[model samples]
Target: MTVIKGCRLICPNNTHDPILIPDREPVYVGRSEATRCIDPRCSRKQLEVIADWESGEVTVRQLGLNSSAIDGIELEKDRKCKLPKGGTIYLLVGMYPQRVEFTYKESPKSPSSPKTENSEKKNKEKKEALKRPASDHTSSNPKVKKPRISSVQGSKSHEIENGSADKAVEEDEEDIKQLEEKLKILKKNAAEKKFAFSSDSEGLLADNEQKKMTSSGKGKRGGGETSGSSLSKTLSDGSSLKKTSAGSCKSPATKSSSAGSDSLNRSAKESEGPPATETKWQPFEKLYVCTRKGVRARDKIAGFDIDGTIITTQSGKTFPTHSGDWRILYPEIPGRLKKLHADGYKIVFFTNQLGVSKGKTTIEDLKTKFGSVLDKLGVPAQILISTGGGMYRKPAQGMWDFLCQKANDGIKVNIDDSLYVGDAAGRPEKWATKKKKDFSCSDRLFAMNIGVKFYTPEEFFMFQKTAPFSLPEFDPRATVSARIVDPPSASLTSKSQEVVVLVGFPACGKSFFSKTHMIPKGYVHVNRDTLGSWKKCVDVCAKALREGQSVVIDNTNPDKESRQRYTNCAKTAKVPCRCFFFTATITQARHNERYREMIDKSHQPINDMIMNTFKSKLKVPELSEGFTEILRINFVPKFKDSKNERLYKQYLLEK
Candidate 1:
């Protein structure tokens, strides 16, 4: 038998056949080099060695004729051919026949050794010994039985029958007394032993002492082989041994005392742990926020006006007066609406669309257009158009009532705490020349009537800047600066009554007075500094008064021309208007000398010239020009009076 590492048998007739011959198993020599026809019945033909296996080289080749031809081929070692199966094959390159045989050897199993057998026998003996009775050794010794209680009990019963019960009882009493004496010694020794053991060890001293007490008590109850005499001996030995150990352990006691002190110190230190980390409690800082008066914290309702308030649309347009018709979002409207939404305000669009009832445009078209506009701006609001015609629009309580009903339907809004933002009349009035309808009657008046504070977008932005309602604390020493200018044309009117013009040098007290007093009284205090454009200040003041709002021009209206602009606004609004000018001496004006100092300190050379010019032109208003009223102000005396006494207590009370 022979084993060949690499060799492959070939069948020339079946080129694609995968089946190997069962009966004709090929013998692999060092290599296989035979081209044989697979069918035994085929005719003989000249054969050639197909594969070879040499020292380091192995190869295979095909040399059979056709499919049906029989080839007498024998394999032998010749040149080695390295087959693809990773072994060598021998080819009969010299044409000599070499026979080979194959064989296999089986591995033997290891036998058990003597050492293993002896260990098994030893384990069996120990197990058997463990099963033996404990009493067997004692039963063989009669002398041992004399001292045992069980044997003594049996002997006492036998002795009682032999007339000796009294002696047995006396012996039992003696044993008990001995046991009591032994127990006292044992407990003392155990305590001393525990003390010694604990003194030597730095840790677990208290724990070990506690454990010893528990173990000693349990041993007495269990009544184990530790006899009373043995317990006493153990106690005496333990005590003496503890004394010796205590000396050696004394150093550890100092260490242990430190350790125990450290332990108790640790225990107490552990008990005290981290001093609870003394969590630094920081006080909550209250943030400053501006809010409207009479507004409740829980109120969520918001009312918005159509027309100029939300869009730049006016009447007589191509579409109906509906908010959707030609009314696009104002540039600042989205941000305002978003802020209101975040603050939990339920935005509701309230508008007076009389055009719809008057056949100007269909309601369906208005809704469609309005919906589209809302989609674009990403604002969702409930639209309430007052097409019922009879004063249901704004300032009328009807719209407010409707809103209240909606709030009751889980809208989460407080009608009383809500705000109305519009640009119309808040109340009706009759001028000597004509009867004027309240423009804000539909929205503004309604809001006021319903106890909701009203604001125009302009006023809203203005209040937003200074947070006047918020009443922030001011630093007296802090330098403040502001540009003084006229109000917007849209905010002022001629028919307006009681114009209050605030005048001061840079940072006296003009703006402070206007904001503190005039605003709360529905006065249109026109500060030119608040206006975006100074050139349009007069026009804005005129427009505001014309709209029937009392105007207060916050500017240095020292000359007549500037004062006349405010008077004209009052006249146009068909209401009484008067110029209340602020007056002070040069010394009083120079009280704001810090502003002059600031101008000088500034790097700009132009500021010095501008400040000089402003100081030169500063003047008090003249009583000429047929003014409806002229008021002279002594600011220094008033300021001193107000400071000594609360200003709100006197001036604010009158309003």
Candidate 2:
């Protein structure tokens, strides 16, 4: 197949900039001048469909768009070499922002789905098996019990148990038909009852009106002067018996009021009927999606992570070396992707571009690079750019959910058939070889979060099968299930007010975990970052200690020198000081630092220099640091909002 892409503007609104058109067939481009503005002299039928796909003869076709005529014209009809004049022929595709180009590139045709073919072969095998005698496959053991059912029912049961294709469909159809019948009966009964109730309500309303009129008429009226005088005398004598009894015995008015309320409620329920069963989702456009074309519903979905999984910097830099510095990791990548496309899978590329969100990289650069790569691969694809760390980022379900709901053309994705490819497999470092592992396991967790199959690029594309990789100390799901080992003096620490110091490098999840656990548990937190100095932290700790409050000093106390200040203050206050050592690796800490720097701007930023300085000075906190107790504080990541989860992990195609 050959694809033709447009590079120039063909519409007044400049909607069409770069458009892809496969070179296999002639493409129709038309316009509607009625709804949109078009130059009066411009032709309504702007473009004629004509293409040459290396065939001896070229074909041409004209299609109408909302009454506009497209002329049919074919060039180089005979096999002769007619080098026609070629430049930019700007054409439009109706009122849409799609431009047509004559330039074409060769591409591969889409192949049939592998799943469909496999199912057909399986069906043939099943038919052959059914033809054979059951005794042939039956166990020789006499104790083996056979199912107790008639031949017809037994065969159906066997089909259901084995999950055969046709029998399952038949059973499902029968079940649906029965449900429809039941629904129809229910609707009929509801309609009849509503109609009867309406008739009864009309009579009740008239009766209520009559009762109101009769009750109003029977009310005793004070008769002229003599009755007024007598009433005054009776009131003076405190004989208000008649008026009290009459007020209490107004049963007709009360009954009418009650009946009216019941009728209104019944009418409201009848009109509203049962609530809608569907839970409507927000439109796909409402989501945070930077999208590319070539997306639609498919049985099999091909999901891939962008940056590391698809393209890597040729310069071997941590970030992008330059705009065009990226090169495909493996030559096999394109072939693997092309196969997925041919096999009826909608290819989608998902990337968390934090730099774009942080104003370091523009979305246009990402689009251009992605377009170039996809063009090189010669495949139509879908690209989802998660422009920020929140909600739509990896390890979150927003992107996956939107695709399954809206982008897939309302087709429900079969999770078993779909798989995600990414590079962040959380492999631990082999220090002896000086090899570093991945930043985090966000990709694997993203797959886990969505409940789909996951494979690293090496395993899937290069067939590098090996042992499973390691996971980080942090588990997003198990954040709440932290195993809190008691301090040596557990009774004193829990019940008595004492000073606690957190020791770790920057972005090691010290402050986050403390906020969630410590502050809520009546532990006052003292942070040097917020207080502006270690002296202020000490002051705050001393004041809290004086106030009989247990304080937690939340800071990256890198070494014994930094930790001694807090321990000394606790000792001066006659309080036991305990150290909570954060147990995340340097790689994890660096990953978190990068995530904070690029994605979340709200938190204080940690530069590479600071991270390096901390690493150089990092010392494990021992009991000799003058702490009464040393507790291990493992990293635990928790997200308050499901849509926005931790996203510091990088997806790399190569280790």
Q: Model 2 lDDT vs. the true structure?
A: 0.57
TM-score to true structure, per model: 0.24, 0.44
Quote model 2's TM-score: 0.44
lDDT per residue as tens, model 1, 293-322: 122222356777766666654454534455
lDDT of 2 by residue, 248-287 (tens): 1111333435443333333323111122233221212113
**Once superposed on the true structure, which residue ranges of model 1 sit more than 4 Å away at CA?**
1-299, 314-329, 426-441, 461-655
What global local distance difference test value does model 1 have?
0.42
Q: How many backbone clashes does candidate 2 have?
A: 5
RMSD (Å) per prediction: 43.3, 29.1
Q: What is the total number of backbone clashes in candidate 1?
A: 73
| lDDT values for all models | 0.42, 0.57
